[model samples]
Target: MAQEMTPTQLQAWRALYRADTLLFTHIENTLRARLKMSYFEHEVLRILDAAGGRLRMAPLAEQLMISRSGATRLVGKLEEKDGYVARRNTPEDRRATWAELTDDGRKALKEAQPVVEAVVATFFADHVSNEDLRAASRILDVLADANPNDDGFDCGL
Candidate 1:
């Protein structure tokens, strides 16, 4: 059985929902205008860049909180349309595959980062006090581990 949420928890959930919706909409629009890609795609590129510009397919899917098929489809778009990403088979295990960020993907991520950083600074950072940030960080960190599958941190609406 599911535990009931306290009234305060319910209120917090509502507030978080509203704020997240607004924030993502703003960022997604900004990204669409400048980068011509969804925020998720941008995130994939960013993650690949951070992971030495490559990651195995299974881990990438998990990190993205997407099914393997979904990850493959998304990567396929990145591969076919813009050549921003590519896949390779491992010689040792032909069944194992990896996706790598191309130079174009790196350049695209670099271009998008400034826009994202500026918007986050203006809308999120400027309003929140340092104390509030610390408190929220603690709360989020607690919530981060609540997922049984360990995929909760990445899959936000």
Candidate 2:
């Protein structure tokens, strides 16, 4: 059997989990209340925008840390309900599909960016010292690298 965590290790884990939950909840609530956008929707747009406004469905799902079908459904909702995203099939590979952000999506993201930034500043960055912030970032990076998803796509860990 594997060794169990030490008391310090357990405390660190709990602290990380609690901090993540609180921050995520606050950000999600702020985004929904201020901009009428779900956190996932904003994340989808953010990822696509970072990828030059278009990405393959599988990679998008990978980046979103969701299942393929979940990505499809989310993209469907963004497309059908809000006209924020569009799907296109590549002629070179009929089986592969791409999700592209619409101009409206860009506009929506632009509007929501400030809300997210303010929340991050107020709830997270503002409270942590710069030294602790850097240390936390490095520690989180190591944790993410150590525990990677098993999905075929590169987790970028």
Highest TM-score against the true fold, candidate? 2
TM-score, prediction 1 = 0.90
lDDT of 1: 0.85
Off by over 4 Å in 1: 1-3, 150-157
Clashing pairs in 2: none
Instruction: List model 2 lDDT by residue over 1-157, tens digit each.
Output: 9899999999998999898889889999999898889888999999999999999998899888778888899999999999999999988998999999999999999999999899899989999999999999999999879977665543221
lDDT of 1 by residue, 52-156 (tens): 999987888887887777788888888899788999998899998899999999998999999898878877878999999899889887885676446434353
C-alpha positional error of residue 76 in candidate 1 after TM-score superposition, expressed in Å: 0.8
Name the best candidate (by lDDT).
2
TM-scores, all models, native as reference: 0.90, 0.93
The segments of candidate 2 whose C-alpha lies over 4 angstroms from its true place after superposition are 152-157
